[model samples]
Target: MSKPAADHYESLASIPAGSSAHRDLSATELPSDGDIPRPVDLGDVHCFVQRHHLAHHTVVFEKAAIIVLGETPLSSVPGITATELRALQQETENKWKQPKTLYFTILVCSIGAVEQGWAQTAMNGANLGIPKAFGIDSNSKHDAFLLGLINSGIFLSVCLLGAWLSGPINHRLGRRGAVFVGSLICLVSNTGSSLSLNWPQLLAFRFILGAGLGINASTVSVYAAEVTPPLIRGGIAVSWQLWTAFGIFLGFVANTAVYNYGDEAWRLQLAGPVLPTIPLLLTVYFCPESPQWFVKNGQRYNLAFQSLCRVRNSELQAAKEIYSTYLLRRAQSKLDSREVSWSKKIAELFTIPRNRRAITASYVVMLSQQLCGINIIAYYSSTIFADSGFSAFGALLASCVFGFVNFLGAFPAVLTMDTFGRRSLLLLTLPMMAVTMLGAGFSFNIPADRPAHFGFVAALIYLFCALYSPGMGPVPFTYSAEVFPLSHREIGMSFAVATASFWATVLSLTFPRILTVLQPQGAFALYAALNIVALVLVFLFVPETRLKTLDELDHVFSIPTRTFIKYQLTEYLSWFTRRYILWQKNADLHPLTVGEEYQALVETDYEEEDMP
Candidate 1:
């Protein structure tokens, strides 16, 4: 052992620039307290970075012994030199290069998201045939309202119903089981809708279909978050939106192919989402349950660790994750036991100040998602295009264009959301969407007799789809899933989805009536104004959750709502401005390393530990 009595401790020997390529860095080893020796040599550091799974080390090649675990050294060893940082950086690089298994799990869970996307477009794609079959006069105002209700109202209302039930279902079933039950329900509901003999029958079945989708949406978003490793969590979580867009695009294309068959073809279109549900129900049994959920529910402790091992890519990483995520999922000791019942949990959402902000922010984000008037374009694009003088074939084709643009649009958010932070992306995209929506509304006043005018209007609507997709489309569902503590995650998201359902029902029920009373231009202008208000709310209230992990959020949300918002926004703007030249070039935001995130989160916690 190196002399501990010496004042200075410096790195002793060479750490080859490139360590052995075969060193399995995926699973780091963390020794117990008993394993550490006494009378530590300050200069004899031998481990890789002298790192611990949960502690931060900053071994300076100087007169101080390195602090590994507690404030004291573990068997005084020569400290790791700065050169060893090269290996440390390399190991970080490997962590993010996720294995095929992680990708496979994400891809499979995203199948449930496809149902979410399909729920919107299925009727949008098929609604073109609704008027003829139901004998509703397409040109009349009342019929237009009825048409909107048929397309969006029923589905959203029952979807809300399903969202309400998701809490208990998922609590009982686990993530995989919840997904299984929800997908099977959707399959059955879609088939029933296809066989509907009349408009009322179709609407009733559509409601059931919405309930199924509600269950899927509520559970799947949480499942996506729970299953992912923290460093890469945000990106994987946002893919829920990506897959939803894919489903919408797929629905539109299928509708175009079958629309030529006239009214009867709608049956097949309604039934088509059933095909994707097949893989979801079949594939879920292979997927692992959520470790965080297991910890929260207080069951299957061994299985939770095993699942965490698979998710984190190694046993040691899984142990660290349990320290970070699993502990935070529960309440701190004071409130821990208060997690007594669902009724108490529900009451706690509003009773605790931080919890209140979390759920309120979640509720409002989802409410805005629906009220922003994107659905007007999504669900009634066929009607809007036809009003703009497109033929029936042309209208259906235009809807397909909207779907494709929406699908492509989500890629930008999928890429940037975790990097620039959620709030930053919202600031950039919401204003752009607001502008495009107003432009779309004004197009109705132009000379529709001219092809240029119609083209211009169609282009704006498509642009709205593109802009909305990247920010508004995916952010709300993901954001809502992210904010709540583990215990309330399911119920909170269900409440948020239910709020979305209420607004969806309201908008779908009212949009057509507004179109008749105010015309398309006025209706859209109103929604644009609402978009501006939502943007302000987000800027002034919602905290930036860019690289912050689920555990750190407990403290983050505890900051006075307005104060945290102001600080985060200031931080964001300062960073952007400092890099203004680079910002102009529009480079993508880079992802955080697992070590970086863990260190950042624990820094404050550690400081508190040092306080007298």
Candidate 2:
């Protein structure tokens, strides 16, 4: 057989020995092509190393059709203009910045901080926990409605405050300072709730708590996604859901402890869950500022880039790569930020078909999770069990079981989310949820007066918790963050989560009334029926987002404004399968193993279109 021609990326594993190795380069400047071949030029840099040389890498270069020569090493050609080269460099640099952990932590801490307010926001149920422990008859329709109203009011206030505060705080204090301030507010509000002597005093504390949490909810996602490495961004972004779930679990466990303590135990219960902050505060103090925030605010770019590089490992030229990456991102952000208005924002969302579909799908996923009856169990099921003749202690014990199940549900997402992606998990879980919810409804269909059926009711409760936790509970938020691009990440996540909060408020406020009007069987039957509807929505609307990049998302959703509502079901299904199955498997081919192929693609005048 003839010897194969030498490939462009043949030496990808090691930088080719060159006279220019000692060239004095600015911290942000990459070497010119004259010093190295195109393949070696790209290979010697951090972006190429992580993107092409690293395992499981998938990067596609757009041709010189969109070059930004002012910012890139120019290759003089007969036809190519300087303007075209500038555009390409700008695009490449923008795509090169990877999502890092420092980027993800802002969301994690903000969510953790806001979660402190959750104790008070849901204190209406907490109050019930105490009364039930004292054998107070609180399952009466009127009492339940009052509790529901309190729950609704607290969540509504918190969400509204969060919506209003997110943009301003992010614009003013930046991510780090804003989070530190929000954490302090949370510490104060939680501490106040623990000391409240009356219901009104407690409710007041809850509202303030909502303000702190609301600010965090509004700002965290954009803050996190901005700094995350693109390769692991999806996984790191979803960890916010994981940590928030963990926080909620802590809330339930603390409440259970108080319930078990009986008289005066509420004090300890209210105070205990706030303790997670001791470490959270430490992170706010020491954590680095978000790199995107620094670039957006025109801060010291080199400093921010260096801080980010440390997180990815400094052995590689990670700092210089980050600097180039930030340059591109900053330029695009400058372009996107021009004259943004409310109408424009809303129009942009729907005008872009892919984003519109993603938005609709996000709404369904949120409803699926909220209506799965997880919150109903966490916040009020103790009262429900008592109505069925379980003792106060018995009902409290059941709620603890519910928490444990939700905690268990959260793990599978952390474990398999990267491998299976969000769409697959959401699609697979919906039908199973419908069945479980229906079963739970039927279990409750048993006459409440019949104490003999309590065991069946209890079993259904456990099954309900089991089905809800591992899948539905933590996945919606993960999907929401994954679907939106970096440019609209903050606003997109804020609005998506706002939708969840809006419905959660409505449900929390009215679930008691619904339960009273429809009775247990009717109420659960409604939620179960919604689960079926949720399944239909996911099948029709959601797209597979598994390994797609932020840049890809921007392009995917940018399909013309006129086609916004047209659901390209066939194309999406094909896209989903290709990405989830075939592409993922074939992607296992390592860069090192396939170096010969890359080498052939990187030529002096190599166009991106010529590669793959």
Candidate 3:
């Protein structure tokens, strides 16, 4: 293709020229410790002033080394020499040209299947089973409380134990193996729930089920974050929300399908998550482990590179492109020899500032999720319908509808998360939630003579589920996971989510009392108030994690000026388009070089002495 016009070139350039711009060079630049930095050397350079003020500057360096021409008030150039310029040019090129892949879709499916299935929606099905076993005709407030406790009990344990296992599991088994193990446990525990005969038996099974669910929930987030290309890290991180929507939808379908089967239907509904686990296991089995995790564990550099290329379906050279980035990052982060024991790592989350902020943010987000009245609706939808003048069967149908709306809403999270961003969506959705909750609660407060009015309450509740599916239901987990550090990711997230489960228990057990003592209006008003609080917390604390890479995020956090959302969005878009454009722009840049030219170049780059 022909070169673009001068205006097009100006628009495409990232660095600005003239006194309007400041030279934002690194305060202290580091040299490359490993691998050849990928800039075309522009050779030697000399500067001379030809005439009056209209002098021109020429830079002879690497062909592809990025150049910026900025105007200064000084009549002559600075004392900086050609050698300094070459070193700076090579470093910048290496910094800019790292390769990336889009394997998050693979991760999205794997983690989505397990996380959405067992942790979130599968429990929604169990809400029906609780009342069925307890012999509650109307599902009184007491029963609602018990059901929440049953679900939340395991969550409490998850908070306690999840951190303990996260580090070891990720360190020893690797990302893929640890995640698969978690999924397997979930598969078995969900199946066990289907066979339980009584409330006590079901409760026991749920505790075991929660343990597996906890592991799956925490580990998948860590694995997904570790494996993603930095450019689309935020978008990939949000996939957890998308899959959760899927699980909620599936729960509804399964619950409705067995509605005609009566009490035994709860058993089938409990087992619904098992269907997705098989594929989740199979896909994760085939996918490569996280390259970063492998490098952290002391694997060879080329092996990690090849693994990335295998999943990316790109050329072998792409391995160097990716590997070179890790080397630079590892050096800069001072991660070369930084190894702490698992126990110490766990403690560090609380003691360290970065980890503290992230973990606290996670806890707040998760606690906010619990306070949203999700469990009250999840477990008591049928009971609420019955109280609102529907038959027991009609209540079950209404519950099914809630699930349908929840499921359908998840797809949009996948689409919108990367577009509108996490913080923007969180800020926008909370007010809508307030309106929906008020509508549902106020419907119950209206006079009894209003015919079909209770149905409006039910419809408003359904709208709440729709609103939740896209924002509250899915976004928090992804956000929590994103904020956590790699050192303690699994445990930190587990602790946060476990808190959600704990509150769910509190809400479940108390909702019956709350509804009865203060009436339905008081109960929903409490949740609406909590939603308002969550909105404020999100505005102040939650960052937009839509586009950032894991490495870039580390750097962003290292500094203190900009919030996470600002840097996250900027860093992502910068490289997201550049990597692909590199290949498109240079069709002639390939691995199939003619004979000795390629062999000698490869041999000179990698000798037997440097094999390790």
Candidate 4:
């Protein structure tokens, strides 16, 4: 082994293993002595950084170490000046002031999101023209089935192949390489889709496009999360949803612009997504590879350090983060000493308690994302508008307005996701989503000849999209990307994405018949009820994960599901009732106390000195 590798192993060996003693603590009871295993101490982490980092011998390294520990007196550390101390403090305080390279990386990821949104909206526009051009009767049951199949073909491919492929592709190619390959496939498949002579040909190309969407969707949020700092991670990670909304809006604009192009307009709409892929293809290679990817793939500490430096404003911040990430990986590897085979990793996602809880949380968010009925609007809003008595041009315009609402709604999350938190946002928005969807569905009850009917339905649909953009829209991907340990992150995310894609396929395939049988009223009511169920599940299962480092999430997920549920039901529920329902102004809800095992692994006793 190389000297650094040898030292790395030695560092792992020196850290104490967590206790295996089992305790049957009650759900509401706080853990007492020996009830939970203790994580590695922060002093040990400081030691690891000092020993392994080549720059540790310098005065700058000393100051960086003190800042990282967050407790050391600057005067106690030799060779540290007041000006140097001020710079270090500024790095943490002004969290948004990141390196230019980091912003560029987020931009690359955002373009990838735009590609995904544009691809989805292409079909939304094409749906209006394709059935007629292919001689398929939308009113015929058999033809309706065929139309649904064609519409859902891409998502079926995503669930079956693309989501599952993300892990191995990421494992082999790294995040940037996976994105590049996915974008290339999209470019080719989108062209093929536009040129298709028949429905079957278009379906085949759509399936190919699914492969790209699945890969990009699974990889981009993770890439963004890995590169971002904990303080601003939510805002940065949410760029995927935010830009995707932009892309959706642009796709609608394209569809409206080409509505006058005769029967071939659908073909042009289907090709609209191909534009964003070109920029994604050209620029993706320039972004830095994820530093966490390096740490997990191999003990490439030097390369990890370099990658971190490119994204962070200072080498000191880079040094602090790399060592912190490295230590957590080491701790996780000790806990899970199994083989690294794909099948084994998949099994671990369920078999391990920490991972299982993460899967449960991921499932709650991802499943809810689909069940909240956003894709129903995304895929078939034009058809819905048309059915509600809109002209072909009017349907396209109304859909465009819907897309604009979706895009504008996402900006709030960029501010609130970190402050309001992931779980809180989901809980807050779901009930509103349910209410708006119910209102929209019932609005169809008004007479078609009345102007209020059109105004009410359109207004309610827009409101639903607005509510969805901030909460379920961004949280699932961001939450799924961060919940799993580095060992199983790719596979865990694959499972989560697969869950979403599978349900999207089901919704796309069945909604046409649903609209036929149940009409708009019943269809909307069913999904509104589903939104309530999703809200209940979120209340019971999903844990809050905002503002925590990817490594720190291990502790959050380590708390038993039953324990978390118990706390929510007994503590949070009552608190909510008293605070909101009863209108108690001074009601306080106690924070959930974690065992030493659940505390942040990198926390130290060092206190920050006041900076002049």
Candidate 5:
């Protein structure tokens, strides 16, 4: 209940009540609380409303002031009784009782995910036939390079240009508008892919398709994160990965359905992605724009309040969120008022200590997402299965099973992501993933004449998919979306997605030749090694972000990377060894104290303020 000094309110109080300055505080200079900053607490919300005279704007602000400050009891709020206050508190307790519109927004976003997954994996079935139809001999080195290039063209475009375009596009048009544009581009590019007369034509259309995929990948997760409540944010935000897995499953089903089409099978496979884009295009406009986008982009706090009201169950809840978000944004704007250009924003990603740590964590997860070797199977599982002793139809069938298992695997994360936490899931699953990849690879060494050879290879690959789906698949996008401060969210996500895309491009472009040269066994072994490396990077760098609100996460990422690494090595490692490895019954592990640095900063500030 403590507030900042009275002098802190002078600048805000100087602004004329009901003037535009009250609404657009970004243009006004604000007093800073020295170099060391603490997390934005509810007191800041109370102070802002009181000093800025914002209570006159709407009843929402008046109610928010009462609720956040607790200066006046619930009985004093105009329309409320104690029962209504209890009900409002119950609403917070029940995170699943979200409004229908929130789910609808998630559905709209999920359709975009379906479009991405379907388009991304449609090539798995097509890979079997594209080389033959294009008259490129897979045996020849140059033709294989051509094949890899064509296969990876979309991802190449994503890393080079499309991902960079997301920030400006999302800023220009709102979240819904960006999704609409991305979906439309996907529709055109996917249709073009089906009509391609040659490999060059196919490559061109796929490259165009990357632009759409990149934008959606960068925007959708952030959209979901902004709109979702903190209690359920992890589960809901991960729907992007869940529906993507479902889309992958559907892609395989489509490929299997068209397997008998002979020369035309690959064409139909490429076109299969175009179906999901239709729903996404038609339905996106109906969903509400991200409320946080309203505040960050244009300082339209009233609109943000209205938007939150649509998604939240009660006025009190909506008011609380909008007020908190506004204060946090105002605080962030004060911290870095000079971030006027995109280049400077990008530079701040590395230049600012907190932003740099977030970037490092995001980069580790995103890069691991690709380097963990999921794409090796995702992009070319049909080819891998075919080489593992299955017939053409048999290979397609095996890949279809892989997709199904991948989809099934994603559901557990929804149940456990918040409870188990992102970092824990990765740590729990990565070693298993490494073992499965290695097992799948070594299974190829079994004699081709034996039934166990095919059985073992397929089973191990399925297990690998099961492990990857819940952890690395969902965590990268979800973590990247939530880690950055609201002001930097768009460009920060773009950078993270670009990192993932760059590695994915490398993986897709190289795996064909890796398969040809090292064979499936050695190739899988290579990825298994990379997965081990990924596990180490995750342990050393990635901080736990589970269950923290977007604003509260400012403190989480503020902890230095070296400190995180040291904790993992000195504290967590010892605890794990005692509790899990050694099976000590009484071993107790301490939670990482995120607020220690903030508390230290606070004590230092108080000491300075008390100086005579």
Candidate 6:
């Protein structure tokens, strides 16, 4: 019997045993043809990989045309020049560095974060005006509950409802398309809210708006994470949080300026988010679909390769990244061998240990984001400031201060996030946050008549925002965005966002009542206690996920849950030492530094042939 063409191609592409494993590799992992009996034509490498299942196990040049001289074997070529080799090396270097298209896409997609943030706190200020415009009596306890239900209550409920809807939207329209639809929904809802003459009309439109932004919230972060290189992924992915804080800052600025406008100013404040949405919709039209999404949908060449090239920056980098994408497709294809229903696929998200852990981690991180009490400050800071004895304008100014400090907080996050890594920062910040919340609780216990005491409270609040900025504020969203497999990234993030909003709604509906019953000090103390619980959750459940590719993570989480602690400690110590050295050089002198070993970043845990 004759050997098949596909099998022959696989043999040609396979690396030799003598070559260094990817973990110990010195240069590009692509080996020379020293072990081959005879050379194969260079022009056919991509075509063979595109059609051959086994060819996916090794890296190959994606663009055959770039090699030129179709009949020549790369190793046997007498005509190849130093310039051609240098051009290839330079292209690979550019791809290894940040590519413009990838960064631009990240920037444009981050506008979704801006819209989400704008909506989140806009109502915080609008609450002052909207209740008055409707002539609703908010004097009694019942009215206060109704007011909470109208403002944050409805928004968060549908926000979660929208998150569930995002799965189908991403599956159907893809991540970019889902973002566009969600942004349009934001524009329409914000426009409708501005024009709404009655409270019910505003509530209805806001509900729709929440659903739209929910879909966006679920999509944008993953869109950024999937497209970024592993080395710079954390820094770039954290842009989602940076822009979100900026949106919150802008919301505070707008609300402060319009506080004097009384009833109508709320309309302009509500409409503010639409400005960012317009540009996002315009630009996301040009951004590529996720390379994994393309491949999983069975596109082997065009869309998948192009998107991978844009995101990974060159054919070689794209080739390396696409190995994981190809593995994902191979896994999905195996499941397709039997008649796998949609319900089965959904079940696998939990039944598969790797995915199950990811979902659990995402839920914990997200719920912690809300339960840690940051949103209470973010969504109701003006209210919080008012209760602390500020005049209405003074309250707005204090909020502007919070917004400025909050914006400043995100700057340090971007710089340290990749270098210091996620787990170490979380461990440090969670404790710091616990202390700050405790201090704020004590501030509430101070007598309101003592204006001198107000400065202490104000200082605590600023310090809290400053401390919160670098870690708890951004890391959860950034982590959740990167943790899922490409197949589940959309729905996984939706679940994370939805879980966060669910808790947020719980606190929003109950917070005003908590204040009414417990008063300010008691409520602040309650938030402090909850933050402590959130810290415990982080300590126990979350694992370090720095410098890992998404597919690389598939192996780590696949290990039994019992082993999580060892990995967590290992990653933390690695970055802690690096950061300690930096701090020693820059700040406090500590001889304590990381003496560590990392088995290279992109090396796969599973053998090449062991994939589905």
Clashes per model (N, Cα, C within 3 A): 11, 27, 15, 3, 0, 1
Range of the 10 consecutive residues with the lowest summed lDDT in candidate 6: 592-601
Which ten contiguous residues of candidate 2 have the minimum total lDDT?
1-10
Question: Which prediction has the highest TM-score against the true structure?
Answer: 5
lDDT per residue for candidate 5 within 1-612, as digits (tens), equals 102322334345555543444423322223343433333334555555555445454555656645643434556766665655764776667768888999999988899889889999999999988889999855778888888898888898888878888888888998888888888889999999999999999999999999999989888888887888877776788899999999999999999999999988999999999999998888988888898889777677767877887888877778877765665555445543554689988987876666787889999999999989998798899999888889999999998999999999999888778889999999999999999999999999999889999999999999999999889989998888878876677889899888998898899888888889999889999999999999999999898888775445766765556667888999999999999989998998887665545545333322232211
- lDDT by residue (252-327, candidate 1, tens digit) is 7777788877668888888888888999888988877888678657544446757866755444345434533422
RMSD of 4: 7.5
Please give the CA lDDT of all the candidate structures: 0.69, 0.57, 0.59, 0.81, 0.81, 0.70
Q: Where does candidate 4 have its weakest 10-residue lDDT segment?
A: 603-612
Instruction: Give the better candidate number (1 or 2) by TM-score.
Output: 1
In model 1, which runs have C-alpha deviations exceeding 4 angstroms? 1-91, 138-142, 319-335, 550-552, 561-612
lDDT of 4 by residue, 116-143 (tens): 9999888898999999988885577888
Report RMSD (Å) for each prediction in the order shown.
11.2, 12.7, 16.3, 7.5, 6.6, 7.9
lDDT: the better of candidates 4 and 6: 4
Error of 3 at 354 (Å): 3.2
TM-score of 3: 0.69
Kindly list the per-residue Cα lDDT of model 2 for residues 1-612, writing each as its tens digit.
000101211222133222122111101123333443222223223353254233221121121211222223345422444654443344346533333555446545645633643453235236555444434336677666666765665568666776566666777888866766666677787788778776566667767766667666665555665555555555556556556655666666666666766566666666664676555666764666776676566655545555565444331234334434544553444333465765566665655444565677678788767766666656677677776777777776776666566556666775677787676776777667777667666777677678646877777777766666556765687778777755566667777767777777888888887878887778878887877777666665565566665544543433332232233444445565666767754432211121222223222111222110
- Better model by TM-score: candidate 4 vs candidate 6: 4
